[model samples]
Target: MATRFSSFVRCILYIYSFSTFLCLHAHEARETTESYHLHHTHTVQVSSLIPSSTCTASTKGPKREASLTVIHKYGPCFQSNKDQLLVLNHTELLLQDQSRVNSIHSMFSNNSDGNKLRESQATTISAKSGLPIGDGNYVVTVSLGTPKTNQTLAFDTGSDLTWAQCKPCAGQCYKQVDPIFDPSKSTSYTNISCPTPLCTQLTSTTGSPRQCSNSKCVYRVDYGDGSFTTGYFSKERLTIISDAVDNFIFGCGQDNEGLFNGIAGLLGLGRGQVSLVKQTAQKYSQFFSYCLPSTTSSTGYLTLGKDSEISSSLKFTPMLTLSQRQSFYGLNLTGISVGGQRLSIPTSVFSTAGTIIDSGTVITRLPPTAYNALRTTFRQMMRNYPMISSSDPLFDTCYDLSKSQSVSIPNISFFFGGGVSLDLNKVGILYVLGQTEACLAFAGNTDPRNITIFGNEQQKGLEVVYDVVGERIGFRPGGCS
Candidate 1:
């Protein structure tokens, strides 16, 4: 009798434990489904990309992939008649970068300043076009809405929120190639409520509070270039390659102002949820790669999902922590080598705090200490060449290229942390200003507050892979064109 009672009790306990375990499992799954269903989504965990959790298992038939043919900013899309025009273009672009740096300063600034601002003062905050100041060299045409409203947008790895001009503007809107996206015309459009986690993610920026208008989440973005876009946060089906992704959250900007003159919107490839990469993570496993053609006449492409080909070819280094300004990808740049001679600079000068790889900025900017070391070493190597003084702050290291003799630019290499080094030739290190002139594609960032940007110049013809799961970025030499 005693043995039977004990066995009965054990069985009951086992059953109870199993019931609780099932309940917990169901609850967790429900939460995940709810979060994903909302479409105003969260960032993808690298762990989630594993084979078991990938979209392949559940997706029937062949997997659908989207590709965008990227055009160069200065290429045929924005053709110029004069070489001087290209020179002036870089000057203006650099000024835009300065403004972008200021915006970063504001983003990482003491929240106490933001906290101190009266509720009214913090309200305002957020534009781009034909390879404009806020844009990168590559551009893509993105289609959003049910009937597939196509808009040409600049691709930016530094920007977070993906926004576009929408119809029924209360204040201001830009002149885009296509008419504004009418959310009402789309069957899949829906406004996000303030109570949802998506709203919290959108408003998490300092001083960018949660503002609900007519029971919808309203967002205002202030970009690095002082461009501002204010609109409602909503979800809609974004069509690409005849395939559509439903419930993609984006900004419906009614008042978007700034350098965005001819384009429709921005395709934010930043490391944030509001970006295109993150939005498509569940379907694509948050893996995306791009190859930028060296020149404007060539074509490059952006691919979604894992690429076994690119991965095998890349050599990678761990990405630094999100110490500040979460959008930028921080990496430890230990030192630089000019003509095979490493610059004797302190490691602290390459602190991960103020270093990033940006897709938009054309020229690289390093801390004054690091820049001077690189410049001094480079100039020493090129003592034979005639130096051309420049009054423009943008082109500091100009050289007279009018001479028939080509400057034998020594091989320059950048050393980053974790045994990773990037070797750049003259083409990658210098931006030729017409046939008569050329300049070192680097700037002295005297302001300690600003971070060093690994700009497009350094990234030319390299297949840079952002491996979020591994927390590393890989680079490989390739003919992108």
Candidate 2:
């Protein structure tokens, strides 16, 4: 009887130990997960969704800096003929965005050794013109040439060559608010000759073979959306807010066609040898920062030089430069937190395909695994709100809040390498289609191997600093203010 009692006591002890283990596991989970409250986000009003007539004040920065006002191409602040602006629906916008993404992927997949340089040859000036501008691009005004003619151009971090439609459009030129640049009028304009080192760089810059048009180096850039620009590779003076950069290599397109939306041309802020950033490296030290306004009606600032006060408030992360793609700026996205809870996504999921921060892409793209976790968690937290259907295939998670006077959203943050945690602004979390058709601003890539993109939508209201010399990218909150 004593032996039987001892066995029974051993069985009771085993059950007690198992129960204790279960309780500890549950407690640990609870500790790791955090809850969110509505007070963490700003209340978004439906009336504010409409674009305001007057432009909001530009983000204040240091005086004497090479700062340019950034205006959304579709916003009211962009003064242009109403007919020039094409009203693209959400579906059309996503289509154009996908086109740009596809082009980037193609560029990465088709990486190859550039063409060999040819023998030295003279340059012949030719009259040519081309179209410019992309959907959802931002425009900035700058002076060009000896007389310094004001020209509004779209700024792109994804492109390398800076080009504008030059005068004497013997071939084809699209309509633009500013008169096409006349090289004859500017004494400073000079065509780049063939076989020159600067001209050979176009092979890598445009991803096209070097061509000489009547002894002049010819450049042809084909965008993903079927937009093409072919023009003489030339040099001219580029002025940005009183800072004049002489001998700036740019494209004087003679043949161009695209939906430029009345913009003169493109300003390449990419990380290539021929990009504006590299051309002005001596003056700016390869340092530049831009703040995208939260709303279309608001104004933002793009500064070329670093500001001491702004630099102090920034949180930095290591910038990655992949061998296959050198012009694009890369970043390591470690994890994401929705409603204050960090999703249980593996680091390998993000590291496999890699990530890039693009000023052109509108919506952020995530790996399927990471996106699924984020979407599921976001849906659970937003369960109280009514779910709505969206016609746009890109946006799947949408909520209807027409009845509510104010929106109380859960806080979302992104954790990057080097312990950098960035809390997104309220505008970044939800993309308001209307009062009733609000949706999460993120989307999932079809394949996990596809590279992730951190789009400009999430970058609104924050100052994004690209320090090429330091090899780091920094983010500061409330930069648009």
Candidate 3:
């Protein structure tokens, strides 16, 4: 019942956000918004919003680009028969503003003691919230606890902490299709203490330390979409295929709530102390990559480490190294082009904050300046077609495809640092409405973070690699088979 209610509430919120726009388009079609949700099934990833001085030689992986000689691959996580329509949201926009506000408040609020770092005493618990955006999260298979209990989970690059539901749950556990993870049955499970450094790192706000529940370290996380996961910290062995990440720390969520329906929980890949990437940095070389399957029916893969020499043929884009906001993977984008001509938007518009390549977001999002420039150019090229107007922010360029025999969409490109140019697939540029209409697959972000995202839509059929250690991302076309 909780799960059903959570899903229902999400759609209501999405409609509310674009209620005016949706009402305007009410006459044209009933599935305009539903159709948009059909193609994209990804979610928003957030790194730890809390600041912690946990990095040391033992914690931070070597600053060298790791070799991808032996690939560890997993398929997309959200593979299921269930319907995936949800309120499409992102970064902060997808979830609650209160969480972001609380994060900011923590940053400026005085710290209670002298032990914590920065905010002098002002400490913002790094925000890591996954708002239910759509049905598409890149699902991966992993096992936790001893004698290994396998779990199907979502892999999020934008998140840093990994967690799962565990038992001794009694009344606290949400009903799931699979058996609840019984920690007592596992030989590897160990409780985390409240006074430990890791517990202190899990503070809810700026100065407040993580609390102790039943003498064990307790952690609480709330998302922007009014969902949260709460549990005690535990240490256990995590198995990805055959590799065993021992002493792995993850939350044993008891009071967990939100958009997650089929999966057990999440696999955090954010750039933070608790992220799986940092935990496996020593063995995996602090880098990993994934190729999302072009369509929902096919299988996609997530690979840890670098690709072989054949990957040298891929185009390269230099990553913007952000020291303060280390949780995000920032890319230096110049501008975009349509019909082989670059848009007139200035590069400064893209530089509003930091552009990160995210697999969680289904459609690509640009700042208003960058988006307006590309929209204008595309409109110019698409003047022959009839325009459809909507208040829904995601649908900017809609066309009456019913009147046209076939649409010869022009080439679209994303310009980035290191002279890298990404040519997008035609199908990825336009989303189809129920039967007669089609809309652009991109959106304009008005976020203060103004973070431009090259979402999964623009990344279809491509083998994209994130070389975090070297500060760059590599892209090669046509691999999502």
Candidate 4:
């Protein structure tokens, strides 16, 4: 009887153990399925992907001291004669963008030898401008010279020297919508003399040693596409809207040629001492914010000073200072998430090459490791949609959603340092080629070590704030209405 009781107890214990094991396994399976669903699934309607035909005005934040309207060069909002518009196709625009990127990479490569020049300390001032020019760039208009000749100039954060084509055209000048700025006519125009501290500063700013032209400091800037601008380094009165700064250093190009799209010249917003950001650091406190419109047809604004109201909404990440490339803004990108699921990309993949945020680059370039994981996951999530072939090598994942009124897409978000996650707007996700065709806006770099670029396309509808004094970059969504 005791043996029978012992056998029965043993059987009962065995049954309970087996039952518990099955339960635990079932719970784990359920948890695994839930985790997969959470990460791999995001469904956005197709109609939300299309951009509006009319211009969407950007919403104003707190009252900024100085603000300028930002316009797309090819958009209808930019008022210029037909001759002034140098419209480029998508392919041409991408090519120009690649050229800009190549120039940046080359600059870094050339300067990596640790023999980089140091920027000189000099008294600086502030200025502003307006207007839109170029195929993929945004432009602003600013008044230059004593009498306040209003000139439309393209503003570029990648470049450091504010330049405009001057009257002489000693080498040659390209056609511009505004009259060629005649420096001789302005009372405030003064050529920077060679051997001056400001002249020496040009070596660090332009990456080329300063040249003397009749005792005046001469500057030459060469773009990657063989476009060159050479002329006198001078100072003049620069007015952005109502704010005016005297003795504002700028380039008076006697010889200029490039695909400038009939704009007067460029406004340098780089971090260098000669850049507008550094020069105006006192007044603006080294603070600036800009919103790139979703479509070229839309209008956006660039504010020089901080907008106190929008401060709380912004997500900030530390701004890194690369010794080799001080002019460009650097940031650490940790990971990417698709459909709310963080990709399986290793953090080392992004850390190896480093990354920079650029205003002039049209398309964002990602490292191959990150790009492949993103593409694969994105394709799996979008398997329901029909795939289309693209002739452009830059964009491979194209989709044909012409027939579907409401297709689904995965949402993408970028994770940066400081635990900041930026969710891109619908406009930032895909490049719409036509009614039927759209392609992923991101591309993989040819070389993994090539620096990753966060281009302006992904910045659409976001208030990108650069606080140089604080050493942080901030992003606030829904900046554009």
Worst 10 residues of 4 by lDDT: 124-133
At residue 18, give the lDDT of candidate 2. Answer: 92
Please give the distance, in angstroms, between residue 192's alpha carbon in candidate 1 and its true position after superposition: 2.3
Candidate lDDT values, in order? 0.65, 0.77, 0.60, 0.77
Q: Model 3 has how many clashing residue pairs?
A: 23
* Tens-digit lDDT track of model 3 for 105-189: 2322232331111111112224333332222255667788888887766666655557788877633665453567889999998
Cα deviation in Å at residue 43, candidate 1?
A: 44
Residue by residue across 1-481, what tens digits does model 4's lDDT show? 9999999999999999999999999999999977776554444566666655445555564345488888777666566634445653678777888887777666565545432222211222121121111333788888998888988887787777788999888888887778889888999999989877768766445655566878999887777777777898888999888888888888898888777757888988877777888777777888898888777778788889774554688999987755566667778899999888889899988877788888888889998999999889888888888899975677899999887886656778999889999988767778876667878899988878777889999998888998777778899888874
Candidate 1: tens digits of C-alpha lDDT, residues 134-155: 5445677778887788877778
Q: Model 2 misses residue 126 by how many Å?
A: 29
Of candidate 2, the 10-residue stretch with the lowest lDDT total is 120-129
Give the range of the ten consecutive residues with the poorest summed lDDT in model 3. Answer: 114-123
Better of 3 and 4 by lDDT: 4
RMSD, each candidate, Å? 22.9, 8.4, 19.2, 6.5
Q: Residue-wise lDDT of candidate 2 within 271-298, one digit each (tens)?
A: 7777888778889988898988878778
Candidate 4, superposed: residue stretches over 4 Å from native? 1-56, 59-63, 81-84, 110-136, 308-310
lDDT of 1 at 287: 65
